[model samples]
Target: MNLHLLLADDDIDDCDFFKEAIDEIGQLTLSILNDGVELMNFLLAEPANRPNLIFLDLNMPKKSGMECMEEIKSINKLKDIPIIIYSTSLDRTVVNHLYEMGAHHYIQKPGEFSNIKKVVEKAISLFTSTNSQLRSKEQFIIYP
Candidate 1:
């Protein structure tokens, strides 16, 4: 089966980059949303169409990814869907809190397009191979 993934980020360029990478990877379907509210609504509105995994950006207008994470975990129907925190900042404090909040994986957005493809490919591979199991804290931050 093709893997269905969701990427929620405000940056249009990032969304396009992610799409291109995903397209190159093949055998995967991705849906991109600009903000947290739209992401939540998309998930809630289509229970059956929800993506298998989520790539969430921490910084967003209207509602932050952190808040969205909290809400997702709180909702029974949405709680089990794996979330990978895809953000630019690698702040240790926030990373620790993300782990505490139950993010399945963490990815620091790469500067290079090649790195983005590499990082995303690895993230998807790990998620599929491990059956969406949460990794150890040391292994949480995925780099290209």
Candidate 2:
């Protein structure tokens, strides 16, 4: 099955890297939003356009990832879509808070190109699994 993914981030380099990784992964469709406002707009624009999974960056201008997460969770139509926090920050408190707020997974953006590909592949596999199992906090963070 082809998985549809959306990534919201402000960093141009990170966005480019993610696109490159996804290109290497193959059989996936990706749409990107540069910041939280654009992310929210895309998500709220049409229910039919919503991606199967979302990769969100925590730090953004106009709106933060945390703020977007809260809004997404509150909206019934968008609530069930899986969200993966893709950020450079590894703060334990923030990670814990995000878990509680209903993010499906968290990934500390890997520096290496190969590592980025690995993590993205793993996240896609995990999200597409049929089991629908709830992962522990330790398991939530995907490492390259």
Candidate 3:
């Protein structure tokens, strides 16, 4: 199965770095969205091909990540897709709030390329593993 990733960040450098890191870390097809508006549009336009993981930056033009999270969770169809907040902020309250608001994971943007790769790998693994377990249980239940 192909793992599709949606990157929602306004920082050009960070976006480029993330793409390189993801390429080095694993095999992933990523869709780039510079802001939350585009992110939502992409999701809304292609519901069938919804990204498996979303890397969202808290700060961006057009719309913020927090606002996007609220919108995403309110929409039933988009709620299940795992959202990973990838930002530079170290605010505990913001992190906690995002978690409460249905963000699947929160990751502080790494300063180094290597760290970025490590974090990406971890995120991808967690996403795939959890989904795999869910699928396994689902299959057993349906077949048994």
What's the TM-score of every candidate structure? Answer: 0.97, 0.96, 0.88
Q: Which parts of model 2 have CA positions greater than 4 angstroms off?
A: none
Q: Whose TM-score is greatest here?
A: 1
Cα deviation at 52, candidate 3, in Å, is 0.5
Clashes of each: 0, 0, 0
Q: Give the per-residue lDDT of model 1 (tens digit) for 98-134.
A: 9999898899999999999999998888888886755
lDDT to native, each model: 0.93, 0.92, 0.80
- Arrange candidates by TM-score, highest first: which order? 1, 2, 3
Point out the higher-scoring one by lDDT: 2 or 3: 2
| Candidate 2 structure lDDT | 0.92
136: Cα error in model 3, Å: 20
Q: lDDT tens string, model 2, 29-127?
A: 999998889998999998888999999999999999999999999999899888999999999999999999999899999999999999999999888
Candidate 1 local Cα displacement, residue 55, angstroms:
0.3
